[model samples]
Target: MLELLAPAGSMEAVAAAVQNGADAVYLGYGDFNARRNAKNFSREEFAAAVSYCHVRGAKVYLTLNTLLTDRELPQAAEFAAEASSLGADAVLVQDLGVLRMVRQVAPDLPVHASTQMTIHNLDGVKMAADLGMTRAVLSRELSRDQIEYICQRSPIEIEVFAHGALCMCYSGQCFLSSVIGGRSGNRGLCAQPCRLKYGWEGKADSYPLSLKDLSLAGYLRQLRKMGVTCVKLEGRMKRPEYVAVVTGIFSRAIHEDREPTAEEINQLQAAFSRQGFTQGYYLDQQGPHMFGVREETKEPKELFALARSTYQSGEAQRVPVTFYAMLRPGEPAQVGVKDPEGRVSTAEGAVPEPARTRPLTTEAVENQLARTGGTPYRAERMRVLVEDGLSMPLSALNALRREALDGLTRQREALPSRHMGSYHVGARYENRKEPPVLTLSVRSAQQITDQLLELGPALVYVPLEELAAHPEKAKAPAGTAIGAILPRIAWDREFPQMLDNLRKVRDLGVTDVLVGNLGMVAAAKELGFTLRGDFGLEVYNAQAVKEYKKLGFSSLTLSFELKFPQIRDLSKALDVELITYGRLPLMIMENCIIKNRTGSCNCQNTNTLTDRKGARFPVVNAPGCRNELLNSQTLFLADKAADYQRLGLWAQRLMFTVEDPQTCVQVTRRYLDQEKWSPKEYTRGLYYRDVE
Candidate 1:
């Protein structure tokens, strides 16, 4: 059976999930998780809580999924080591640094890649497997076919989000909150700015960016058939009642291999939902129908109360045990108990100085032993041996039973934790050297006019799709070495067109190409082109960067989510690029926000999505039927020119996503110190205050 995984925000949620039917429960490790805002557990709380789940036969995973700064990596690694020492089944990770340093901490602990890794393709899964990731939580945006393909090809186990609140932006990619006010979603502080009203020049009273809750209860059979190893329910911050109701519905559905009833579906909705529910990107259905805002509706009292009753008492009598006892006069009464896992414990009371009055009856002995009401164990069977005149004191009998059970509980928790093998250093590992040059990523050929090309940069990058669409408008003149930036995400529906565009760009004599996501690496390799990795490649650590360097990438772009110091440290390992100027892309939503309102994309080429705060975020109609939401503030790092040289980067990629040709020229000159430039509206972005 596919494992039914549940989220536990609190110890109470853990009890509810395990009692209801979660095969596994995953929670945060200290504060290093994607849900730091949740009432996460302290170290002591985590140790005690996991023990409670352990006795109930439920596996516990520690979530270390948030991105870690270089300074915080050691602490995060130490936390994983502690969790592993406490007997956690596995640790879910996102940052590559966590993946590398964790092995040094707990060598035998299983590391499952978190969905925030955005592992949407088989190549990504393969990359994880190559790095020794035992399991992968595929991106929630993957379709059923794509997921099945990855499952078939991936060497590691696949875990998918079975139910949860769907983020409008893909996991691990959104920078809206971070750039807006320093609250980074990648580091577990998501303001959920998507839920705020963002209009497309319409009167619709709905939140366009907010997708309804994803309910995959109706598709468990399909996932099971596709060989998914685990179905994860996404609500660690939710109430215990919410976790219980959601876990129960999915557990029953998975167990019976049957679709949930409509009543059960409504109960799930009533438990907690945005507006109603959506199946989300699993089926590859992205459109207006998949959208919904948070409709103010309380959870059904009956359902909430019912789920609450499932774990009303923290002490759940789940562990079954058998006991053997011998009571004799003038000797101690010894009691031995054995738990299900073959662990045995015995405790003996003080000498049973013969009962003074009313010799201890067999009925009284059974009564005292049966009072295992408050403990986590239930005595299924017990065997008693006694002499003809044995008279045990009630206090001694009670003490012996309590001591034996207590010893049994300690024995159960004392089980040794398994360690994953340590990471071995490879010969390919190398560090950065020399000051980096500069590259320009122009959105339009108009921005790459002949004059701008005269500045003499190392390389100029143009979008392959845009170049193919308008070779005349996007063409680079003679003597200009132009590299094409391929699209980041390649869906099945867009793969054909993307391949055609790659071929067209190849035929156009553009051999230098920059790859975006993992899939693009394979595509660019197949075309026999020089590959430059993009920011979307998510190179966060020295190990990950070295891996890419070993893969033959000419130069890689470090993720914008890193601080200047972190980038400098990673750059010391390999050639890397950073977008020093231009508007940062906040999200690449599959569902077009503009089309959701007008039912037609007129290609107006210029329109804004007005938010509740009246901040107008630029929307670009991306190729392959996608939409890109640009950050309202432009990322300008002209003042950090010396820092780039000090960091020893490969180059500073000045992207011109929305800037005009003249502004591109001005920005280029300013970067080169050929001309002075300053902007009234600009942001330092993560370069100053990185995500946690």
Candidate 2:
């Protein structure tokens, strides 16, 4: 059966989800989740919520899925440990260091990889699976056919997002947030600059780049039969009523035989919608409407009224929550427990019996409530009509209300407030001034080893040629052309350059490396280097993350083609840490950009490219190439430090080369030093499938 997962922004929303029907609820506490602005749970609330969900037979997944940094490491670890202890079914996460910390704290807890990890293809799945990840959230950008291919080939269970808002940025491959507003999407401090309106070459009134929400309600049957284990909804920033309705709709469709009609989906669209819903990248179309157009609609007064009415209709009247009565010998007493549906009954633990009027204080009532594990939802003064016609003081009545309501069992709540937590430190390096994750191509082993020792890059992605030549020898020292890229390049018929590069890197005191070639990962294991898998391997989901784990790579980068739901699902299904910061290498071109024009091109010479910040990078135009104008955007995330820290990512990487290394390092460092640094806006780059 396909699980219908729903998003809840608060405790009330969580209850609504369970009440309506949700197989699992994904939420967060403090700042570990992606919806940093949404109202989330506190630590205590999270604990209570988890217990409530478990008791009700609903699974609770805590999102510790944001990227993290060195300074935020301690807090991230503590959060992960606390979530495990709180009985969290699993901790969704990204980043290697954070994963390591979680493993140390809760060895048995499942750590799902966040979509920010971006596992695109079978190789990426194998890599993540090897790393111990149990599942993968397939990227929404994949076509239905592509997802099926991944499912058939993957080593773990697969989950996908069936509905909700879409981002123009690819899940693991965006730098816009970091570059434009100091908030790294990879680290969970995305400012959503993409949602803003801007004029293109000729259009003035519309946001040509903004995307619509994703809706897959039409394909529920295909998803279930394809062996998908979960279907997620994307919205923690929505209202509780919205959560209830969406959950209700998806729940019926996924678990029951009844499929949703087009009419039901249309009703959903009217609830709270953007321009319109699309299938996202699932259909492989990049039309401007792929992401719905933005719309500003007033809140429906009727909906709010309907919600309040629903709340009242479902409320059980027993005692006022503020009542302050104490248990005494001869005062009037109230009796019975109230069910969630507000039915009154003589139950022991569900609701508490009324206590006698006595000297009562708020503290005493609070203590009693804690002891009884109940949260009072409503308070009212009910005359305890007795045969003797005796009445108590209003204070006494309040005390009684407090006692009864306080003692009621706590209920499930949604993810915690979006405002808490720290941004991953690595994102600080990913502002507008930084360079992309550059591949310094080379052909020798001896030259690049020393450089590898000095700079901890996003990844030292090596081409295939040199890997065959070096065949297990150490590379040369830093400061030479051969020092940075040569060793790992494929060189000989069977030189084993990958093993050679790793061996040399380890021997020269280098600890980290990145590569796409699967053979290189196995070879690196033989040499004992801390390895991270790269995008070239096409990791689109959590399964790929787990696959990489077994191969011995320490980290994994996500595919740049994933949509929002795919990103969230992948984050929730993994058991390893993930990463999602740095310059998104938009498209790995078959031919280098510099080949045609050694100087520059004027792609961003339009108004759509400029904002408060001056123009940053120019768009390069290759009029006849497979991808005609390539405009790569810079990452400038300085505001979302709290979010990344909460998600538990290890490092925010900046793919760099000597041409712009210092700028890359300084950008991150400056962002770390000052939490909010907005660079001049640059033309946004395409994360994947850049054709124009």
Q: Summarize candidate 2's per-residue lDDT along 1-692 as a digit string, tens digits.
A: 78778887888877767655676788988776677677778888888778667545577888876654343566766777777777787777665556656666677777676665555555555656776777777555666766777777778878888888766544655555654445656656677776665443333344534666888888888987777778888888888878776777777776576677776686677766777788746765544445446577776666555544433345322123332333333533453434444534221212223436544444444443333223324433222223222333444444544444434434223333221233222212211222223223222333345334344333343333344345343343343112222121121222344445445545555555566544245455555556665654555444345446655656655544443234333442222222333434332121222322233333323212332333322222221121121123444344544433343234444333221444444544544453234546422222211211
Best by lDDT: 1
TM per candidate comes to: 0.84, 0.57
lDDT of 2 at 420: 23
lDDT of 1 by residue, 1-692 (tens): 99999999998898889878798999987778999988888889988877887867688999999876655666776688778888888888887767777777787888898888877777778777876789999878888998888787778999999888999887888878887867888889999888877776633245888888888888989998898999999998899999999998888787777989999998888888877888757877778888777677765898989889878855557677888788787777888888888888999877655556667666677777877887877888878777666576678888888999888877777756466444443343333566667789977666778778888778899888777876764355565578888877666556778788889888877888888776567778888899898887777767666657667788888888878877766534566788898889989777778787777884447767777666678888666667888987788888777776777687888888888888888888999888878778888888878465
Candidate 2 Cα misplacement greater than 4 A, ranges: 199-206, 303-692
Give candidate 1 regions above 4 Å deviation. 202-206, 314-412, 417-435, 445-447, 467-480, 492-511, 522-529, 541-543, 550-552, 565-571, 639-643, 676-680, 689-692
lDDT of 2: 0.52
Cα lDDT computed for each candidate against the true fold? 0.80, 0.52
Query: How well does model 1 score by local distance difference test?
Result: 0.80
